[model samples]
Target: MLLLATVLLLVEAATAVSPTVRLQYASYEGTALANGVTQWLGLRFAAPPLGNLRFAAPQDPTPEYGVQQADEHGKICLSTAGGPPSNSSDEDCLFLDVYAPSNATRNSKLPVYFFIQGGGFNSNSNPNYNGSGLIMASDYNMIVVNFNYRVGPYGFLASEEVSKGGSINNGLKDQRKASQWVQKYISQFGGDPRHVTMGGASAGAQSVTLHVTAYGGRNDHLFSAVASESQSFPPLRNVSESQFSYNGLAIRAGCASSSDTLACLRNLSATDLQAVNINQPFPGAQQPPLYMYGPTLDYDFISDYTYRAYAQGKFIKVPAIYGDDTNEGTVFAPKNTSSYAESDTFLQNNFPDLTLAQLGKINELYPVEDTPSFPDSSRFWRQVSDVYGEIRYICPGIFVSQQYAKSNIPNWNYRWNVVDPEAAAEGTGVAHTVEVNAIWGPSNVNGNAPASYDPDGVNYPIVPLVQSYWTSFIRSYNPNTYRQRGAPTWEEFSGRNYNRRLMFQTNETEMEGIGRGQQGRCAYLVGIALGLKQ
Candidate 1:
């Protein structure tokens, strides 16, 4: 009888250990996402940012209820009403998702990629970012992560009211906290903490730039590499000015007075507080007004401007890949309405470095002969869009590349110039978000289709190539050796004189000149965009 009972107990233990069931994670008061080879979603990283924690840095996720189901994503970060209502948001919005090869429970440590979503700075959530394309293209198992940071005033408000009490740049603080969380727990989900790569596009890309160049101290040795798509660097763009200088914004948000700013603001309802600063108009408010609440170059987090920091070689030396899509500015910028002479005037006045001869060469290459080429009353809009994208995104990206190249760091650059005329007629082309679907695969979200842009219908030919290169870089800190083995030999950046950019022009792939003289032309045009160097 003793032997029989022992045998029965052994059988029960064996049954409990099924290959299909990996582990269960609890976050958000007991919510769970079953971990295994297949897939899991909505794993909490921090506690809800509600009530007393509304405007403070996010706290580590704590269990509140019994084992909660994490099979589906949680509600998104709260967005402004009337726009797309975010589903995976809440005051407790810090969470991440996982996707493995259905049979990923093997003991080997796999490469991980933590994604940051783009919505200028004000909108977009991580739950909307999927990982199919990235996983399917390489053998490296992906731990695609997404988390919510405070948005608008509730998260970014920096008033003497709150600053006096030591609360500033709560949104950025949340990002740092999320990276810390990944370092502590990602391995439990089958990811290699030392082989992680953090990446994103647009605002997300900017976040990646910040992480590598400014917030490196917060990563705690979690990520091995970094990649950014369509990252921007505007004139006078400094982390310090953006974060701590809330003098104007504080008054606009009615939190100017330090005496009781935090107490008074904290007492108000979430919605009411969000409205306090709505009347204040910010520059570049048409898109991503969230920049109003971004991090400043303060001692608590960042110490200087990102570009200046990079130039001084104070950033992390991890291998990085940065690129921009074709016609990127068309979607983000407003219509053109200035004349060629006006554009010329703008450039000449701002970028004194460029002469009339050089400016004329730039216009000739990009073309501004026929004003009607653009429908707007003035062709200046087209000039601004093209020039702005080059100077703001492309030039800055390349500037970083040049610095990396000079430092002997592995840096790869690409320009996605493939423009679907059909997409462009509707006002969207290889816009900012176009490459996302190809990188992360198709998401189930509704508005995936921008009003003027089609989904491209078919899979992008270079999706695998790009994804493989990225994963390889994440795993080995070099894009040279991809998982699938065979891939294009991507070259490193060598400056304008010997420029070469991996140009993805169609369903077919190829590499070509780095626009030869176009890079210089773009730099000159940037003078106009920034009202500097013209």
Candidate 2:
């Protein structure tokens, strides 16, 4: 059957013409790889959100006159001037890329896997979602979709003046458009839109959960399953509360007096908007100012706070797979704090409405770990990392899974314990995002360098298992059914094992069931989150 499917796909690839249209698109043969992989790169699913359309919801593209060359990648969205992936930062960067088996045919009906790139919605680009590795790793068993969306201020700047119709979470709206695009056009690429699953890590993972909660749980039939690596129900501000950032941004952009702040800001150059640095790479030194641009509770797209929506059982009913790193907080944990008081001050200052009582509870939950690897780690820093991990990431994942498990939601959960040996030497085990290269395969292009680096080769013994489980879920919305490489049987999450998680470690450590160790520590966070919603 596989051989027959291969012949059919090769024949179709040889004679393919684009039948799909967001508005009359045409297909072109993409780069044929040495390993026989093929791609249709830089495909535009929506019209460029430039000028008058800036900050507005995405609109479908205007039909083209002829087949657009999809051999090259699209420009990445505007990012910090020196940040990675590309120097081709522009407002007209809303594009997506598709990858498939060399033999995949339009009639193949292969499962479509839509992946969103994560960078805290501040940095990173579509280039970060290198799908070639996934194809190479999965042997082209599925079609992969990767896309670029507005990031930072260009995507998430919010204010009441702009909130009238400018849309608070335009970045997320762009995400929705990308998913919708797949449902409509993926068939031409040998993809089954009905079998689509969405996946993300870090900010991308947050986006998936947001989709799960968008508009009180409307599925929109975009994705039937979701794989969230490092998913979090991040603390976000309501539209009214976001007025502080909006007021400051408008003033900084010299649009303070404009009756239509959105219009005035839209007319400004992308350079002008990018000039105001709203986010920090870490929590100290030059990291003055609190907060960064993120999704806002507009009472429309994101009607309620995320945790509140989940606790009330108001999210999409799809089965979900989510997990966090064993040392997830180490990467984002605040640095340079000298005393416990500094940590307390920073937390109270950064997070809005954080009460002293909560702060006290947090202090009690985590103490300084002064192990040789974590030598002299401040009580403040450790405590902050603990709270951040719990409230920001850990609890959200477990609590959501448990909620679903109780209702028989069949959500799968895990924790990543395998860190690169290099990071392990520093005591920061498996920091956030180390698993991405294992799954997507890092981009081969490195600015005038050869595609020489291969993380999979270094990660050989374990890479296949992780990649298989992910693709398995994408294909069948279940991982156990496609268990590969003698990988262990991953159990569906249930109330029977409430806080239990599949511990994903190396061969020596072994994948096994590990009790959620922080249930008691996390309860305080869950309570605080619930209280805020009420």
Candidate with best TM-score: 2
Poorest 10 consecutive residues of model 2 by lDDT?
A: 444-453
Question: Residue by residue across 106-207, what tens digits does model 1's lDDT show?
Answer: 344667887777654455544445554466666645656666666555556555445665466676667777777777765555566777788887777877
For model 2, how does the per-residue alpha-carbon lDDT over 1-534 read when each residue is reduced to its tens digit?
A: 999999977776665334232335544446656675677777887788888788788898876665566777788887643333345767788888888776666677888789888877865433635566676656677888888888777788787776775777889999999998888878777788888889887888999988988888877889888999888565677777667666777788788889877788888877777776365422222333233667887777887887778878888888789888776766666656656677776665556456778777777676655323255464455556666766777778887788788678878988877656656655565666566665664453233111221444344455667778888887778887675767777788886766667777666424455444588777777888855441
lDDT: worst 10-residue window of model 1: 27-36
Candidate 2 has which clashing residue pairs, if any? none
Task: Tell me the spans in candidate 1 whose CA falls farther than 4 Å from its real position.
Answer: 1-37, 80-89, 215-219, 235-259, 277-279, 282-291, 336-378, 443-459, 483-487, 494-498, 522-534
In model 1, the number of clashes is 33
Per-candidate TM-scores read 0.79, 0.88
Q: Which residue ranges in model 2 land beyond 4 Å of their true spot?
A: 1-29, 80-86, 125-128, 277-291, 369-380, 442-459, 509-517, 531-534
Model 2: per-residue Cα lDDT at residue 51? 88
Q: Residue 297 error for model 2, in Å? A: 0.9
